[model samples]
Target: MPSSAMPASRTDLDQQPPAAITAAGLRKSYGDKTVLDGIDLHIPAGSVFALLGPNGAGKTTAVKILSTLVSADGGTARVAGHDLAADPQSVRAAIGVTGQFSAVDGLITGEENMLLMADLHHLPRREGRRVAAELLERFDLADAATKPASTYSGGMKRRLDIAMTLVGTPSIIFLDEPTTGLDPRSRQNMWQIVRELVAGGTTVFLTTQYLEEADELADRVAVLNDGRIAAHGTAEELKRLVPGGHVRLRFTDPTAYRSAASALRDVTRHDEALALQLPSDGSQRDLRAVLDRLDAAGVEADELTVHTPDLDDVFFALTGGTTVPHQAEEASR
Candidate 1:
């Protein structure tokens, strides 16, 4: 529960870095439908934070408001040491947003798209080209700098979109479903880019439906459901919230399995596989306890593996197994 608020002045901020973003009682609604209900967010600088939800879960709405694309009806927010409402221009200056959809101009070359972003940032002509070239090279788009973005693959387009966002060198960037339609390899490539960004002290706030992506890249994640935060924590902590966790003991010898099953007293036995499954939280202490008891009873397992509920399980459990139309909408795009 550390504060994410930096001091009022940049000089003071240098001594103590505050949270890049902090919000309390952030509310937004459309007509009678509430999109965010008194939500709170605290994002630290230089870390990757993910917000997860199904279609129409208000993930998009939250991003819109935070990025200054939309105004919230109620609440207070601070971004990069500037109050969101009081100084929206400063907020806009300090952050970049790359939505789920590609923003590249299909008619223009990739480098032109980057230069356009530089122009939007108001950099001088020469400086704009320099920044654009650096970002293009950094994002591996140097080869296709002059190629029209329409010719690029889905992954390449997404990379170009992110590179454009960095033109202003914003301290924090919002990536809404950046890798949604990409293949496995492309998705992995995006993840590595995010890692490199954070390593260089850039704060990333991305929204995604891919559970594995969040688990792999995020230092912290929050599950948004029905206009509220259902759960928020590290991947392991969220996984522990669900119930399907166990330690499995497999044996080649039926007699040893049976002996262990008898000694264990409370376990599901698989006669065909000669395995005994004991409910566990998949914690080291729980695993150690199981091992010690087996040793005391002289039961030897041929193989042992710990199984814990993954992020998908946590997502389903927290979001009530609801599928939304937004996913379909994203697909058709």
Candidate 2:
């Protein structure tokens, strides 16, 4: 149970406003292989929820089931307030999906792709053109709107793909590995677009192998392993589950540094830098205890910094130490 003393702004892990997507006992399998096993999820309206896992861990399967592209073996789901199994047409009308592969037609111009999506949505010709123009400009593809998608760079193609998806202006969107092949700048641009969409009341269901992307963008993150959710919570809450977090105390004064080094015997020391790295969970109680001990020893430090396990650590610890190859490369950089 969480402490009642915690502020209301950041207290509950499961507490949320009305849901945009809900699933219970979601299960799927192919022949003898099970992809998702009794998975459950609740994604709040107008928020970014990230589903994270290694390759082939059912991330795409979950997205497909919810988007009504693939049927689940067992589950009850409601998307955009409509029963997914009962009212798939209504669900489809309220949601958009952008898969790992680019949906852009290389033979067609970016404007053409947008207009195609508009046509699929059965928009009026004049309204379709207006929406395409507005979305193209919003995604910074107005200049290249007339250019063939084949002539666009990888990043530009991705931007155009998302812009085309937005032509229908669905209330909810599912982006599965949306930035897998893009450059760092392009990935960041995609993140910004997600933020703006959420700000405008769009719910985002994001599935990615990148822990950094989840940590930076998601209000809630669920880590899946072996077709089941290993853990689910806010970023900080998940990080707290793993060990190896610590607080570093640095001192400029030789005497104070020496005193702290002696008093804190369990610390990892960097003598040349006059820093003592104390093993801790980076909790408020732990910080208070460390300060009380230092005061008793009459040692004052120059600076303090807390180091905690990042989403990468939490991911590997829960997901059998496996990471996506591309995400690992980006993390190193």
Candidate 3:
């Protein structure tokens, strides 16, 4: 990739928010099998940080350890400014977690589920009810508050699960594959909810099988592969790490196409389509260079398009094509 396509340096760390979560040398294992091997992370407050990996790559294990659900074999972590090992209670108080599966009680109404979470947080009865009611409305579950959770759709149940997570007003939340099995519309709805959470100054730590989810919501993304962090950066930065970006020119006239193709050096020609593809990083400078060459050649292409790598391309490259299978992850849950 060209230097012009690279992400700008984030040198203004002093102007950024304090980290909502931080970890170093985070190691975990089950007997002979290592789950996490010295992974490190630093997520700023009021931003979304996404973790992506293939099955058994320890994405959920990382979440469990940080959320105080499981202990790390060797590591140090802090959440909401509380040390994970020394003050787990404080960390629990400051954070909430919604795993891949819904934690809602199918036997009870959605309102009951919210109230249950409020009680676990030890809120006053009156205040618990107030927060429960408010959250139910906010998540658009108020109308279904009186119905049993078993009757709710997958999307509604997911919304309820998140609403319950907010009952305690946690400053940080961990969502591990939160939208794994939802329909397209439901998935988009969940994305919107994540946006709303970040807008309200809540730092989100997300793990999802959907690459697009991370691409859409994450301020920064990390790829975990084989119990290690392979790469970590903003979406665009990671995308730029992969090659195969190019600028394509298509011409309707055979004469113009031949002239342009002959003038342009090192281009992949599509004879049937009358198109030429030039290697590029999709940067403005690269585009300008291609256009300059075309202008000098005195040939005008009918169409010009820039093709750059997306998250899918980045994920495949970093993981050696071991992309997360959403259905497989969902089944494991």
Which one is best on lDDT? 3
Please identify model 1 stretches exceeding 4 Å from their true place.
Answer: 1-17, 253-255, 321-333
Query: Candidate 1 vs candidate 3: which has greater lDDT?
Result: 3
**TM per prediction:** 0.87, 0.88, 0.86
The alpha-carbon deviation from the true structure for residue 267 of candidate 2, after best TM-score superposition, in angstroms, is: 2.5
Question: Mind giving the per-residue lDDT tens digits that candidate 2 earns over 93-156?
Answer: 9998999999999999999999999999999999999999999999999999999999998889
Which segments of candidate 3 are over 4 A away from where they belong?
A: 1-11, 252-259, 271-273, 295-302, 321-333
Q: Per-residue alpha-carbon lDDT of model 3 for 1-333, expressed as tens digits?
A: 777545444445557799999999999999999999999899999999999998899999999999999999998999999999999999999999999988999999999999898888889999999999999999999999999999999999999999999998999999999998899999999999999999999999999879999999999999898898888888866765677788899999999999999889899999999999988877788788888988999999999998888988877876886443232222111
Better of 2 and 3 by lDDT: 3
Screening candidate 1 with a backbone cut-off below 3 angstroms (N, C-alpha, C), the clashing residue pairs are 4-19
lDDT of 1 by residue, 1-333 (tens): 334543445557676656999888889999999999977888889889899998999999999988888999899989898998899999999999999899999899999999899889999999999999999999899999999999999999999999999999999999999998899999999999999999999999989999999999998888888888777777887776777788899999988998899888579999999999998878889988888888998988999999988999888877886442232222111
**Model 1: number of backbone collisions:** 1
Instruction: Tell me the whole-model lDDT of each prediction, alpha carbons only.
Output: 0.88, 0.89, 0.90
Tell me the deviation in Å of residue 319 in model 2. Answer: 1.2
Q: Report backbone clashes per prediction.
A: 1, 0, 0
